[model samples]
Every structure is written in C-alpha cells, then in structure tokens.
Target: MTQSRPPLNAPHSTAQSAPGALPGTPLRSPADVLGTGVAFPIGVNPRGQLSMVSGERAVTQAILSLLMTARGQRVMRPEYGCRIHELVFAPGDATTLGLASYYVDEALRAWEPRIEVEQVQAQLDGQDTSRIVVDIRYRLKGNPEPRSLVFPFYRSL
Candidate 1:
C-alpha cells in the first residue's frame, strides 16, 4: 500500500501568524491606518490617483461640502446636512434673508467642527434679482485667523 501526503501549498496546522500577514510585522494604529491628513475627492485630478489637501483650502472645501449637502441625503444620518437649497425658492426679502442666515449658521454649527462661525449674510444681487450671494465668515479651530467664502445661490423668478 502507498502512503498519502498533504499538498505542498496547503496551510500548516501549526502556523502562528494571521492569514496573509507577514511574520514579525507590527500592526498599525487606528490613527495611522486612517491617516491624519485629508484626502482629496476621487477623480479630482486627471491622473485618477488620490490627492491630499490641507490648511485653508481644505477647510474651505469642507465647508462647501457641508453646505451643499441637503438634510436626509446621507445614509443613517438623516439630519446631518444643510437645507440651504430650500431657501432658493423662498421669497427674497429682509426677513427671508435673516432666516436663511440663521439656517446656515445652525447647519454649520451642527455639521462642521473645524471652524467657529463668525457671520453668515445673504444679499440679493443688485443687477440680478434672481441671484443671492451668501457670504460666510469663520475662524478655523485653534487658529485666530478668519476666512471668508462667498457663494452664489440662484433661483428662478
């Protein structure tokens, strides 16, 4: 009778290392694995490789992203976004502008943790009544310097 043997590529029963992990390699910390810097949006560049952004530019982008997201849009976090789009259809007047500003402030405070909101102003365009200019001033967290962004919101008459 011939004796049978296990396959050469089969995993050893006594191996101590986890599957696919190299021996003696240390595991990375959560922060190290997640990274400390911000990553740019996918396909942001022509090359298709991921990119990074930091400092003022990154903060600006973050704020824009938060403001653009509508409530109930994010999965499992229905109240995490802003309702700025709804203001576009609202009657353009002093009271409406004040309400819009209040909404913007509230949304930013709830969603963005990197900045302290200084002011949010909504102004109707002089030449184009259908457009409203939203100016947001904020101070970055742990920094005294203030940054401002002006975004245009348009609505049909």
Candidate 2:
C-alpha cells in the first residue's frame, strides 16, 4: 500500500480546528495542556514522594517560578527569566511599580504558553514601603474564568 503526502505548496492542515472550536485554539487534553510537575520549593509529600502539582496549580507554580528566577542566573539559559530583578534596587515609586508591571507582562508573554495575561499591576505594599506587590491577572487559554496571583517582591531580597 502507498501512502500519500500533501503537496509542499498545500496550506497547513494544522490551521484547521476541531468542530465547534474557537479560532487560534487547538484541542488538547487537560493533562497535555495544563501540565504536571514537581511541586515548587521541592518538598516531599506524606507518602515520602516528591510533591507534585497539576492543572491550574501547576500552571500557577510555573508562573511563580518564572517570576522568581533572575535572568542570567541559569548559566545555560541566560534569558530564561523575568527582568523584574532589575528593579530590585530601584526606588519603590510609581515609576518603579510601572516598570515592574511591564516586566511581569513581558516575561509571561514571552515564556509561558498556558495562559493569556490580562493585566500585570504592581503596587507598593501597604505596610512595607520596600515591598512591591505584583498582581498578575490571567486566564488559561480555552478557559474563560479569570485568575490572579499576588507575588510580593521585597527590595531586601
């Protein structure tokens, strides 16, 4: 039996989606899309096995990991992290907060594929002037509900 391949000039079939699908979306299993991973901070579970996170929690942990890693800290992947560390020493003012917001938005947009960022707003912590709270509002693709994560960045860190 002979198998046939589409002509080289043919339009990609990947452009098409499953019926009742939305544009720019691909049908994927929850496990494949949301992902599973070892829990961040590397702790063991009650079973004495490494902790794991999946679905939304896994995605959230991935985002936090990306935000926490400083660019260039990873020797091989020099560009693997958020540039928000650049503002670690900057004055905790509106300008600094704005820049932080921009960094968070830019980094997530570049590195993460699971969620669409809606807003990234940084504000000074009410009790601690040196703490800038980065609020990230985002939604997983194919999922409509909005979710948020509050990451507190301390200048002292």
Using TM-score as the measure, the top candidate is 2
The residue-by-residue lDDT of candidate 1 on 1-157, one tens digit each, is 9998878765455546545676544544334332344554533545665666565666677777777777889999989777777776878798777876777888989877778999999889899988878899988775687889887777554
Q: Which 10-residue span in candidate 1 carries the lowest summed lDDT? A: 28-37
Supply candidate 2's per-residue lDDT for 74: 90
Clashing pairs in 2: none
lDDT of each: 0.73, 0.89
List the candidates' TM-scores in order.
Answer: 0.68, 0.79
Candidate 1 TM-score to native? 0.68
Runs off by more than 4 Å, candidate 2 = 1-29
Q: Please write out the lDDT profile of model 2 over residues 1-157, one tens digit for every residue.
A: 9999978666564666557766535666677779999999899999999999988889999999999999998999999899989987899788899899999999999999999999999999999998999999999998999999999988766
Candidate 1: C-alpha lDDT: 0.73
